[model samples]
Target: MKRLNIGLKEVQGVYDGPEGKLWELIMGEQIHIGGFMESMVMAKKAGIKEGQKVLDLCSALGGGLRFLVKNFKVQGFGLDGTKTMFDEAKKRAQAEKVADKIEFKLGNVLDIPWSEGTFDVVWGEDAWCYVTDKDKLVQGAAKVLKKGGTLAFSDWIEGPAGLTEAEAERVNKFMKFPYMESGKGYEAIIKKHGLTLKSSEDLGPHFASCIDLYIRMLSEQLTFDALRIIGDNMEMFKGMGGEMAFMADLARKGKFSRGRFIAVK
Candidate 1:
């Protein structure tokens, strides 16, 4: 895959500003495909249990972290690169009365501050696409996991059919992703880190439907709200919709996808 110039600064800007708010408006606090249902599915597959210590990489708004805390009774730790997300996550945790069970840190996933074997599970949602160095991200996750610990995540990935260089470039730039890995690529990385790959599934079809739902929300039900988040800039709103439509098309064509993976260290 061809890498884009977009990096942490660009990603931080998106989450710090109205664009991030717009995403939350459409996708809710989870901000990923399938949201709560997806989280439940991943949690079950990962075998999350009560009192397990979990680390969430790129834990925007800490929705997944809170979900696990509330549902699985796990203690959660979150790390995000942007202050806006980190602060909001903290506020939400306090309000939800899960503050004691969860901790939020403002830091990059590539440079996790925790020591080796600090967590029983290292998790992520769709946010890892914004990471520029996925190899290091996986390595860091593996390092922080106890022996026999799990690494579980779902991410936007190049689909089985794959994207051409041009298509990949356009999507990466628009989405502020440094690059995307295919499901197979991620499997390789997991194995390279000496983790036992338990599962790798392509959720491209579901991802396409989610994109359609988002487009409909923006164009119909949430049009006014979406515009307001972006400062009532109609041009920007339309542009964003167009980009999303393009992604939806690619997803339907199996050139772009969401991949779910489970591995044990």
Candidate 2:
């Protein structure tokens, strides 16, 4: 398999662009997964509670951390590998007035900074697709989670039949997914780490609808901004658009999906 080369740096840079903010504008407080309430519902179901320590793995700009601290009343520690995103996340946490309750650390997902069984819950948003080693990432989460702790995350997963190498390369290159896994592949990894699978669900509509609406939103509303950014590089924008369209087509065909995994240690 080829590496997607997507990371905190690439994601942060893209998010810094007009398209990035557009996504936030469209996604609103939910980020990219349709709605914040859905994520919160999952968090609540995972037994996240007041004052419990939580780890927001692969946290970018502290979105998930902020939600955990504010809605769930949990103290948060966010970890990300990109220095730029780490700084931005720190600023965001402070801006949200939750910096006191949350700590942003610059680190990789494969290597968590805390000790074994350090947190009550290890939560991730729709961000783990960037990590290369799925098993190691799962094991690391399990290692840092306390006994009875929960490992809850929603990620872009390979659909039931999974992705072919060529298709994987296409999707990964465009979406910045380093690797994607089947739902059962993820289940097996979590089970291998001794975590019990509490629930698993396909979150396809969110992805499919969002991608569809995003393209429409751009075509109808963001044409001016996109032209400004893509000035002199219209071809680059066109190429990316083709890739995005391909992704949307795949989602429509039920060839790719986003899966929400809630597991207990």
* TM-score on alpha carbons, each prediction: 0.99, 0.89
Please estimate how well model 2 matches the true structure, expressed as its whole-model Cα lDDT. 0.79
lDDT of 2 at 195: 95
Model 2, 1-265: lDDT tens digits are 5567666566656555654554455566445475677677778778788999999887776887888888878999988886656787889888889999998888778888899989999988877887778899999999999999999988887776556789888888777667787788899999999999999888776778878887886668766666675564678767766877888877776678888888988
Among these predicted structures, which one has the highest lDDT? Answer: 1
Q: Which residue segments of model 1 deviate by more than 4 Å? A: none
- Clash counts for the predictions, in order: 0, 0
- Model 1 misses residue 122 by how many Å? 0.4
- Each candidate: what lDDT? 0.95, 0.79
Candidate 1 has what TM-score?
A: 0.99
Q: Give lDDT: candidate 1, residue 31.
A: 84
lDDT of 1 at 100: 98
Which lDDT value does model 2 have at 98? Answer: 92
